[model samples]
Target: MCVPTNAQEADTPTDTPTEAATPTTGYFDDAGNWVPPARDAAPDTDNCPQATWPPEPVSTSERAASTPDALPVTYDGPCGVSAAEGYEVPDDVLASAWLVADLDSGDVVAMKDPHGRYRPASIIKVLLALTVIDELPLDQKVAVSAESAGQEGSAAGIGEGGDYTVEDLLYGLLLSSGNDCAHALAQALGGDEMTLLKINEMAKTLGMTDTRATSYSGLDSAGMSTSAWDMGLAYRAAFDNPTFADMVDTESYEFPGFGDLPSFELWNDNKLYLNDPDGIGGKTGYTDDANHTFVGAVNHEGRRLVAVVLDTTINNDHRAWEQAQMLLHEAYGVSGSVAKLAPANTDEPETTTAAPSPAAGDDAGQEAGTAWNRWWSYAIVAGVLALAVLVTVLSLASTKKRRQRR
Candidate 1:
């Protein structure tokens, strides 16, 4: 999670209690001010004109198991089943929306308000980075446009006409959480409107059902939103790229000055990398509307886990990270016996129950209702080999003791 360094920290956002439309008139200027196109200027492509901000909540079914849209159709677990079964839950988990998922199994191990759509803040930058990394060449130098130089919030400090490589901009976007870096990349990828469209398109393709990208930078005003589950899915997709993995995992980067922009060092905003041995690195996000949001991955005891925490407390010892750490620690050792809750509907926060966690003899428990199959063959093989090795070691040690006794 982020230190007090990130600005835009405030209580949960109250704006757009109803659906807020994506602004077609203009985008944010250098000062992070909204700039409209000229009176006769052609309207920017309104890719998501029908979509509105803080998407209007829809009605859902009363049953948890059959709860419609409880999770994105692409998620592996049962549509309406509680994902938290078979795991020990963390205490005082301050996040209003969070998820802990098994990437290898594609199983959402645990969640709370997983489908609640909330402002994403800088977390939006990750999608922007992925989009750019795919479309633009990292070695290509992009000239900082007026809009980019004028961008506000945490910035890469790109001055007007400062030309930087796509590589540096990505580093700035992910590590520094640079709003200006987001703008530069978005512009490079064909302006903010098109980039937002690309973001949503990728979200659709990746099966990230609740994410809507209206802003390149995650300004609360830009109306970017996603659920905790959506973020975990998005991050999982991003990590597939070697470039993204390299950049996000980097602790710090040294940017070479170009043109009017002087060289500067950028450090990752997330402390999870520095503090947690298992942390695989991810991004941090914050805004008045989003509060403290984070999406990260970790390798715990050889198991890959991705976690998302949204709307966590602002000043409580990085509650999001702490909660994630505690949860990951438990997840590594959890038995497959805890009962699960039914999945809540997309539009509601209600809960339902699932059958108790499977017993040793239970061959057909939680895997019955989902679209995905468990991919535990590799794990089983590895486990067996490890056990065999442990037995051999003990046998050898016992023989040594026996010899000494003789």
Candidate 2:
């Protein structure tokens, strides 16, 4: 399929399509909005590879390869309804891969190309946040280094010679989507190399086998990648940590000024979190290669639902968050499933809490910290393990845990 060469960021919805002298490449929707070609077509495989079985693992660990056919057969299609026979998926989703799943029940309510590997952009920050949330103390102070202060995109206003706390940086990281904050936080977690290792380990613990973090802030890296399915798993697991959950929900934070810099307030960049009443929280990201990526959660009728969209282009009809809102709306009443999200892995060695002090040439092969944070163990890991065990027992008891098309 020929993709549109000229794609513009999404604009607010309108009753009529815009007229122009030059013709556009895509067809308008029922609302008369000019949907872009990228929204309606599968991504060019030359740019985005399909999620094949036994994909190249980033780590050399001996774990089993992810099941083929893209986990659940229903989600194997490039374009079709996986929710149910008559369910209508929104036509303007603009994503190459997307998923809507129940965060609490783990049921994959709706999806398309759920396991397609694509760049995650800044949504990968959620993984970094989870990795260090238990490892670093909120009050611990950091001296902003020149590297962090000079980060390329979307700075949180940190300056060299400035002193900030983990809490302050957390605000910048989530609310502002600060790349500078990510770098500073990575340094605190050991260093870039050690932090990436820990972040990938966290991905494994959450059963996100399709994800591999090569950058601290989700920037495009040679081998960095994630999928809609893996993103859903990571987001769902992130909510288990109260600190992460609260940070994403916070709308505004007052970051303290240091040295010659003046104190300034940072606003949350997640439109879903800012707009929807039921919106619990979410993260948004974009890069040239990633286009637009998002992972967000909403509470509807007491059920928490999470949506992930990867490799999307914004159109006049919807932005990444708007597409996510559409998915969540369609999922509220969905009863069928392609497959339940895999439960979090509890056997991950404790590597973040008290790992050996940051040393030279650190890699994944290094030994994990001997001392595990009791709070994280009891609060996060223990709870996740119990849930995993419960899911296993239930699955063993009932063969029909996952729904099939009639």
Candidate 3:
């Protein structure tokens, strides 16, 4: 099947029609506006200015407020795949973009903002993990690179010259959202260029057409992005691999230090693991640009429901989990499943900010333009400082203890 392609940083829902629907052709401009892909028409992807640290992701609020008639995107809220038939999506589900699907049958149970391309933060590590797992053996030993060890953000406290097995790195990558671990794996597997080639290849094989593999760690890079729908596709492809399942599902791991080095402890961030009995495991993501994003799964009886929630904001870290929980309950209650999401053109003007309630008539969308908001940036900065301090303190203490022992 030829999946419709859009030539933009963000997805502009296309009319695939199997040569059935009217063909819509365009790419997104630098302003996140859709334009034809013609060289004269579309913004040059090569010359597009890369986003800097104090970055800003495209906002849903601004898009909602735009003139609807000129663009391919007519709607600003959920793709309209809601509770119907036996499924029951509550009226007050809180998420910028979300989806719950049955991986067993490749069926979409329900979805919200399915195609909204948002920042993934560290969650893209799942794709990197999935790719490496397929190529490297669990016991394969790898030497950490300076570039990898010096990476910013969360880490597994791997030393500059640490040598570890693929299995150990996987534990760190999934359990701790370790940017360093992700980089080490990338260096071991291949450099950035080759690693991304593999990841994009994996995405293509899984039919995640909306995803762009711009970074190994899902750190907000120049053009890296994914949607809830795309994440649903990524995780579905990943969960099928037993290695992927085992790692994310692990609550805690101890990496035995090499020789006299200090051991590292990694705790899983998939909070659902502890609170929900049916929760299998998942990855958590956060960045000033991406806000709080998540890709999680739950298994009940014989069915597995994978839920992808993106951009829950910094203030409400639990919103994504709660939203996923609601989706699972409603999915279990729903009788049958959609063969897949048959989302119509998202061209409509119904999205508006209103108090979330049980009222189905209320458009299920929140005001969401300011993604890289000031508060979120501050939070990210604080988190980074705290993590840096943690790594530094641990390293200093370990060095002192080693000197004493010698």
Q: Which number leads on lDDT?
A: 2
Order of models, best lDDT first = 2, 3, 1
Residues 133-236, model 2: lDDT tens digits: 87999999987899998887677889887879999998898887888899999999989999999998888787776677778787655566677878888888
Give the top-scoring candidate (TM-score). 2
lDDT, candidates in the order shown: 0.63, 0.71, 0.64
Write one digit per residue (lDDT tens) for candidate 1, span 124-176.
77778878888999899887887887776677667777768999889988887
Model 3 alpha-carbon drift over 4 Å, by segment: 1-78, 258-261, 314-317, 339-406
Better model by lDDT: candidate 1 vs candidate 2: 2
Candidate 1 achieves a global lDDT of 0.63
lDDT measured at residue 106 in model 1 versus the true structure, 0 to 100: 53
TM-score of each: 0.65, 0.69, 0.64
Error of 2 at 39 (Å): 3.9
- What local lDDT score does residue 57 receive in model 1, on the 0 to 100 scale? 18
| Residue pairs in candidate 1 whose N, alpha carbon or C atoms collide under 3 angstroms | 20-53, 30-150, 30-151, 80-343, 81-343, 82-341, 82-342, 342-352
Tens digit per residue, CA lDDT, model 3, 324-378: 6767777886656443632222232112221233343434322232343666988
